[model samples]
Target: MSTFTENAPGVAEQSPEAAAGFTLNHSMLRVKDPERSLHFYTHVFGMRLLRKLDFPEMQFTLYFLTRLLPEDSVPEDPDERTVWTFSQRGLLELTHNWGTEDDPDFAYHNGNDAPQGFGHICFSVPNLESATTWFEDMGVEFVKRPGTGKMPNIAFVKDPDGYWIEIVQPDLTAGLGR
Candidate 1:
C-alpha cells in the first residue's frame, strides 16, 4: 500500500514561499478482484496492463495499467514502474489493492458530480461523438449525453465498474464555440 501526503516537503516547495505546486501522482481505487477489473479495462477500453506486483507480505496485488502507451515501452526502472506514459497527456493509475475476507464487494456507484474530495476520474478525447459512439457500440451505458449545459460539447460515460469518464472534443471552447 502506498501512502500519499498532500502537504509533503518537496511537493510544497515548487512555488513561491507557501504556494505549492501540488501535482496529482495517481488515483488509487481498491477493487475486490484485480483480474476482473483488468479484463474489464483491457477489453472495454484500450488500456494495457503495464505491470503487476504481488506483495505476499502485504497480502495484496498492485496492477498498473494505462491507455497511453504500450507495456513494452515502459522504463526498466523498478522504482519508476508506477509511472505511466502518455502522448503528451497525463496518464491514469488504476490501483487494485486486495480486499480482506470480511470486506464487502461494493459495486461501482456514480458519486455526486462535484470536484470536492475524491471523485470520478475524467478523460478527454479528440472527438466526443466518435468516442460516445464507440462506447455505445460496446454496450456501455452513459450517465449523460452532451448538451445538458453542464459542460458544453462534452459527454459523460461510465465504465463497467461505474466509474465516470468525461469525453470532450479537444479545444471545444477555443473561440470556435463562442
Candidate 2:
C-alpha cells in the first residue's frame, strides 16, 4: 500500500475550505513518565508549559509545551491558556497515561526499528560543536555524537523515553542560515 493520499482530479484539485489559513500546530508524543519528560523539555530543551489538561475518568493527562518569546506570557486562567496554547505554532504535546511509568514491561515503540515509522524530533542550534559539548556536559546520552553521523555535523541523542532527538547546526550542518 502507498503512504500518500490519492486525489481525484476535480475534488482534489483545490477548494476554498482547503485553502484556509494553516498553522503547523503541535506534535504529540506519548511519554511514559510525566516528570521525566517535563524535566527534559523544560530544563534541558527550554520549553514552557503552555497548558495542561487532565482527564480523571480516562486516567490520562496532556501537557502542552512550547518555546515562547521572551515577552510572551501564558495566562493564569485555564480557558485563556488553552486558547493561547492552541493558537501558536511549533508546540510539543506530551501525553501521560496514568500508571504507565510504573509498569515494569511497558514500552512504546519509537518507530525507528524494523517496522519504521516516526523517526525523530529535531532542534537546530547556532553551533553544532558547542551544542554537542553542552549536551555532554549535561550528561545527556548520545546515539551518534557530533561529527560522526552520515551527516557529520549533525548529532542524534536519546531522551529518557528512548526517543531520538536529532540536533543540527543551521548554516553548517543543514546549509541554512539561522
Candidate 3:
C-alpha cells in the first residue's frame, strides 16, 4: 500500500493538491439464498430494494439495496430509476447464483468461521434500544448482543447466511471509534 505524507522523501511538505470527488457505489456480498438475504437486509437493517438484475444464461442474480432517506423517492420510470440507482452511493449489492440456495449442503463462507477473509458490515441506528427490542421480537440471530461484547454499547447480529453485522448507535459510535 502506498502512503501519502507531507514529508515523504522528495515530496514537498507544503499543502497537498486537491483531487476530484467520488462516491462509493456499492459493496457486494455473494449470497446462497436471495430471499433470505433480502429479508434480513430490508427488514432488519431497514434497507430498500433499489434495483435487481437477473442473468438467466449466467444463472445468477444481483440485488441492490440502500437505506432510503426521508427525502428520497423511488423513480417510477425504468430508465430514470436505473440512472438514479447507479448515481447513488453507499449501496449493498447482494448476488445470488441460481441453484446454490436450493442445495442443502452448499453454503458460502460468511467470513466469520473457518477460512476467514472478510470481517463484517455495519449499520448505524438512531436508537439502539428500540432496534434491539425489534430484533428480539423478530428472532434475529445475535452473534454479540449489546452490552455483552468488548464495547458494551455496540451490538452484532447475524443474518441468515451467518454473516456478522455490527450494529451501532450514531451517538455512541464516538467511543467505539466510529
Candidate 4:
C-alpha cells in the first residue's frame, strides 16, 4: 500500500522563510440563491457578513463572511474593511451568478454525486454533541450524524446550497488516540 511520507515523491518542499505569513484566506462556493445562502451561513453558522461586492457588468455578486470572536473589531471605512476582511483566516466566499435563483432548473453541482471532485468544508466546535443537537433543532439537514458513521465523533451537515459542512470538535483525533 502506498502511504505519504515527509519526503514523498509528490510532496513539494517549502522552507519556513519561503512560506512565512501565508494563510488560507478563503474557499469559495457558488450558490443559486443569495438570500437563502446568506441566511443559512449567517444564522445557522453564526458567521457575520464582512463584505459584499456587486458586479453589474459581470452580472454576479460576492459575499464574504467570517466568524468573528467578541474581541475582534471591524473597521467602519470601506477600504479598511476590505483590508481587514482579506487578512482574517477561515473566510467563506459565496458567489452568486445573477438570475440563477429565478430559473427553476438551475442548480450547482455539489461535488458529492458521480464524477465528484470538490469536497466539504469543516468547522470546529467546542462541543460536538451539543453542536449536533443545536443543528438538529435549527432544522439543518444532516448528511451524516455523529455516532452513526465509522468516525463516530464527526458529523456532516449541508448548507443551503447542498454543499457539505463537516462538524468536528477540536480534540477529535486526540480522543481517538491518534
Candidate 1, residues 1-178, lDDT tens digits: the string is 2344467566732344443544554455655556666776787777776667688777877666667543356667865655443221344555555564245666534464444344567666777788778888877778788777656587777665567777778778466433
Candidate whose TM-score is highest: 4
What lDDT tens digits, residue by residue, belong to model 4 across residues 26-134?
9999999999999998988899999998999999999999999899999999889999999988899999999999999999988997789898999999999999989
lDDT of 2 by residue, 50-89 (tens): 8889999999999998877889877888898899888888
On a 0 to 1 TM-score scale, where does candidate 1 land against the true structure? 0.65
**How many clashes (backbone atoms < 3 Å, residues ≥3 apart in a chain or on different chains) does model 2 have?**
0
Kindly report the root-mean-square deviation of model 1 from the true structure over all alpha carbons. 7.6
Whichever of 1 and 3 has more lDDT, that candidate is: 3
| Model 1 ranges off by over 4 Å | 1-23, 69-72, 76-89, 99-105, 108-110, 113-117, 175-178
| Top-down TM-score ranking | 4, 2, 3, 1
Q: What lDDT does the true structure give each of the candidates?
A: 0.63, 0.84, 0.85, 0.90
Each model's total of backbone clashes: 0, 0, 0, 0
TM-score, cand. 2 vs. native: 0.85
Which portions of model 2 show Cα errors greater than 4 Å? Answer: 1-17, 174-178
Across residues 22-68, which tens digit of lDDT does each residue of candidate 3 receive? 56888889998899889888887788998998899999998999999
- lDDT against true structure, model 2: 0.84
Query: Which residue runs does candidate 4 get wrong by more than 4 Å?
Result: 1-9, 16-19, 175-178
